[model samples]
Target: MNIKNTTSIFVDCHVFDSGFQGTRTYIQGLYSELIIKRDLHFFLVSSNPDNLASIFGNHSNVTYLKYKYENKYLRLLIDIPQIIKKHKIDFAHFQYTVSPFKRCRYIVTTHDILFINFPEYFSFFSKIINTFLYKQSAKWSEIRLTVSEFSKQKIHQHFGFSNYEITPNAIDNVFFEDYDKVLIKNEVAQKFSLKKYIIYVSRWEPRKNHQMVLKAFLDLELYKEYELLFLGNDTLSNPQYNEIFSQVDSEIKKKIFTLKNTDFNTMLLLLRGADASVYPSMAEGFGIPPLESVAAKIPTICSDKTAMSDFSFFEDYYFDPHNQIDFNDKLQKILKENLGTDFKIMAQKIKEKYSWKKSVEIVYRLIKQNQ
Candidate 1:
C-alpha cells in the first residue's frame, strides 16, 4: 500500500490520552475521515499508541506512533521532530502550541485566546505565558486554523497576522441517531440509578459558569423534580462554583451530583437521558456540548456569550449567562418541556453546515492548494 507520491501528514494526537474534551473530538472527528484518503498517509502521535489504534481502528493509510518521553516539552523538542524526520512528513498538525524549532511544514490550530479576553478568570502567569506562546505558535505555522468565527476574529484582532482559518467542531453521528427514549432512559436509570436529571457537560472552570446554572436550578425549584448533574472533569479551579454549592441546603444538595472522567459513550447515554441540558458557560472558543445536546433532541438552554453568540440557532433558548433571572426563566421553560424552537428543524440545519466530512474536505483542499 506504499502508494508513491502520497502526501504524508503527521497528526499530534496527544489529546486522545486526555479524555472527553473538545480537542480530542476535533482530532478524532476530522482525522477519522482524513485517514480514509488513499493519497494521504497519517502518522498519529500519542503516549498510548495501542489506545489510539483501538479508537481509529485498522486503516492502511494510518500509523499510530507512541511518545518516547512523557514530558510535553521533551516530546515537542525531541520526540516529535524525530518522528517527522523518520517518516519524512510533509506536514505536521498541532493544537495551540508548536515546537519553536523548525522541522518541516507545520500547521497549528489555536482554539482560542480566551485568557486574553477574560483575564479575570485566568492567572497572571498563564495569561502572560499563553499570550506569547500562542502568538509564536500561530506565527510559526505554515497554516493557522481555529474552531469558530468568533475565535478567528479574536485571533485576528489580537494577534494581528490574521490568516487563521476556521475548522469548526461537528457533532458525532451517535447524537443524531434516533434512539428509543424510553429504552435509553431505562438503561441509564438502571446503570447509574439516575431517575430524572438535568446535565451540564463541560470541563469545570470559572468561565464555564457552572455556578449560574447551579443557582438557577435551585431557585427555579427544578431540583424538586430532577437531579442536577455536573458532568465534567476539573481542568481549572472553579472555587466560585464550590462556594455556591457549599451554601445550598443539604436536602437540596442531595439532589445534585458531580460526575467526572466519564468515557465518551457513557457521557452520550447520560446526555440522551436528560430532562434538559444547560450550557451556561461565559466564555468559549467554539462550544460543542450545547449543539450535541440539541442534536440528541434534549431540551437545551445555551448562553449567548462570546463564541456562543454565533450559535443563534438556539433561538429563544439562548439566555444571558450573567443574569441569574434570565438563566432561571430559560431553565424553568425547558424543565416544563417548553422547547421553544423546533429542535428537529434546527438540528438538521446544524448537520448540513457543521460536519467532519465537510470540515475535512476544506482542510484537505487547503493542504493540497498550499502544497
Candidate 2:
C-alpha cells in the first residue's frame, strides 16, 4: 500500500493533450491528484514530443517520455519493451486497449468494447489491430481498469476478460459552479445568433449516431423555431461524412453549425447554457457529456442503452437511442418543460455521485491495491 516506494508508473497512450477526449481528461485528473499527494512517481509516454513539456510540464515526480513508432505494430514489436526496461518502471498503464511490452506488470484501461460489438465502424486493418491488441491486453494485464460496470460486462461477454475493476469518469469541479444560467444563455445566443438551440457534444463518428440526431431534429415540427448546435470535430475530415455534409439543404445547413476545436472552458460554458443536451450514441463505455450536462444543471437526454442508463439520475430522463419517435418525444418534452423539477433534482444527484475528487480517490486506491 506504500505507493511512495514505487520507482515509477508510466502512462502509455497516443496523446496527453487535454482536448483529445474523455480518457485524456481522466488521466490528467488522476495525474494531478497524485502529484499533489506526492504518493507516486508518474511518467507519461506519448507519441507527440511537442506535448511532452507543455501538457505535463515540470512536475518534480512526473516525467514525459517521447515514444515514437512507425505504427502501433512496430511499437509493440520494438519501442514499448525498450522503454519499460530503460526507465525501470514498476508498473505500466496502457490507456488504450494495447500494451506494447509484457516484461513488467501492467494495467490496461478499456474505455469501451465498441470495436468488438460493432466492427463495421472501423476499417478492416483497424478491426484486426484492435481485436488483437484488446484481447492480448486483457489477457496480459495484471490489473484491468474499466470506466463502468456496463463496459465490464461487455468486455467479459465479447472478449471474455473478467478481472478488471471499475473507475467511473468524473466531471471537473468548475462545471458544478453556480453561474447565471440566463446570462450564460444570453451570451451563447448572441455569440451563435440564435433564438433557442439544442446541443450535441460528441465526436462526429458513426458510432456517436449524429446522423440519427440530425434526422430526429429535422423530424421535429417545432425545429423551425430552434437550432441544433453540433459541437465537436468537423465531419469534413472523413470523406463519407464530408459527402453527407455537402449534400445537405442550405436551410438545414444554416441552422446546423459545427464548431470544431473549442477549448474546455468554453465547452463547459456552452453546456451550462444550452436548452438541453442530447446524446443518442449507439454504444459507450461511460458517456461523459450527459454527466457533465447534469453537473452544469442542464437538462440532458441520453440513449437508454449502455452505461448511461445505469446512473440513477438518468432513470426518468433516458430515451431509446434507436427510435426516432422516442427522441422526438423527449425533445418536445424538454422544449415544453425546460428544466423541469425532476431535471433539477437529477442534476443535484449527479453532482453527488460523479465528482473529480471522488474519481481520483478511486484511481489512487486501485494503484495502491495493485502496488
Specify the highest-TM-score model's number: 1
| Error of model 2, residue 185, in angstroms | 3.3
Show where candidate 2 strays beyond 4 Å: 1-6, 17-19, 47-58, 68-79, 189-195, 221-223, 234-248, 356-359
lDDT by candidate, in order shown: 0.88, 0.74
Worst 10 residues of 2 by lDDT: 234-243
lDDT of 1 by residue, 1-371 (tens): 88347899999988877757889988989998888788998899999999999988988888889999888899889999899888898889998898776788888989899999999999999999999999998888888889999999899899996777788899888889999889999998899888899999999889998989788777778777889898988899889888988899999988898899888889999999998899999989999999999899888889999989998888889998888898888888877775635788778888887999888887898889878
What is the model-wide C-alpha lDDT for candidate 2? 0.74
Give the per-residue lDDT of model 2 (tens digit) for 1-371: 34357557877655453244778777766566656656677777777755665755677777777767747667766777888788778778777655555778887888887777777666778778777878887788887888888989988898888777787787767777788878988988877675477888987777788776677666674468777787786432344445665876788778876777886767876787788789888778888888777777777788877777787667757888788788888877777785667766876777677666775676677767877
User: Each candidate's root-mean-square deviation in Å?
Assistant: 1.4, 3.4
